[model samples]
Target: MIIGLHVQVTVNRPLGSTHPEHHTIQYPLNYGYVAGVIGGDGEPQDAYVLDVATPVRQQTGYVVAIIHRRDDNETKWVVAPKFRFVTEAEVRKATNFQEKYFQDDIWLL
Candidate 1:
């Protein structure tokens, strides 16, 4: 089935000057549709559910792709090897909107 953009990420918190995490990187800032699924319930087909917009790919097998970052100053795609789901957390300390929007859903890692 086709699902929405599964943004599997690991939020590395900010540390001391010497202990700063380099993974603050945003990498691919955007994602696109990969697949879709049939949505429905046991209520005599009340409606078709579009689970495709949900980020469920995190539970499925890993899909290999390339992440090309220029070494010098060139705009191109480079291969960084395959990646899989890890975790996702909203940035809190960096922005106050996280608390304003996410409200009780805000999570810090």
Candidate 2:
């Protein structure tokens, strides 16, 4: 339902950063959540930032897709810069770092 909405995502897990608990898992892209918005997990809405290579503190873009973890209850939003278009293949490749461990689907706009 949030697809096509523009939002600012606070990048808590920047690119190249290691997972807080799982050191073996690293972030290939910036990932964070939207402030004040609650998601299915009862926390800030989590998002995976796309279209950026370097580690950033935050990102402002449109919600391009959602990574729905079939086994898990959480859904990660995919955000991309203004005017930028993201494909399903790109989302898979960018989020494979962690999503690979779970059964998921790309919910596109």
Candidate 3:
């Protein structure tokens, strides 16, 4: 029985190019997965598997949720579900080389 789930994600940022400075910014994001809603068995529901297109439609990246947090001087991994959204188009446009590079994390296809 699956009680919980964990997923890996990647983040990409835009950078200036040409005279300004031809450079690209990339970020590798990681976080624990938590169901947005509860399931019939009283467990958390898994996030519906979506391709890079999902983020493109929203024009946002997936937010990185730091499960570990500090509250009242007590630090522990919290279930805040905080995340950053990514664009599907940006991810889809990624090259196969990049995808294989970040295979452990989010895949670009």
The predictions' CA RMSDs to the true structure, in order, are: 17.7, 1.1, 13.9
Candidates' C-alpha lDDT: 0.22, 0.90, 0.26
Error of 3 at 100 (Å): 8.6
Model 3, range 1-109, lDDT digits (tens) per residue?
Answer: 1212233222122111111232342312211223354433354422222333322111222322211112222111111123334344433333222233232223211
Q: 9 in model 3: Cα distance from truth in Å?
A: 12
Model 1: per-residue Cα lDDT at residue 66? 21
lDDT for each residue of candidate 2 in 33-91, tens digit (9 for 90 to 100): 99988988899999998888999998899998989989987999999887466788988
- Candidates 1 and 3 compared: the better one by lDDT is 3
Best by lDDT: 2
Task: Estimate the lDDT of model 1.
Answer: 0.22
TM-score of 1: 0.18
Candidate 3 runs further than 4 Å off: 1-27, 35-86, 92-109
**What tens digits encode model 1's per-residue C-alpha lDDT throughout 1-109?**
1112222322122111121343343222112221232113211101111112332222222222222222322111111113332222312222222122332322111
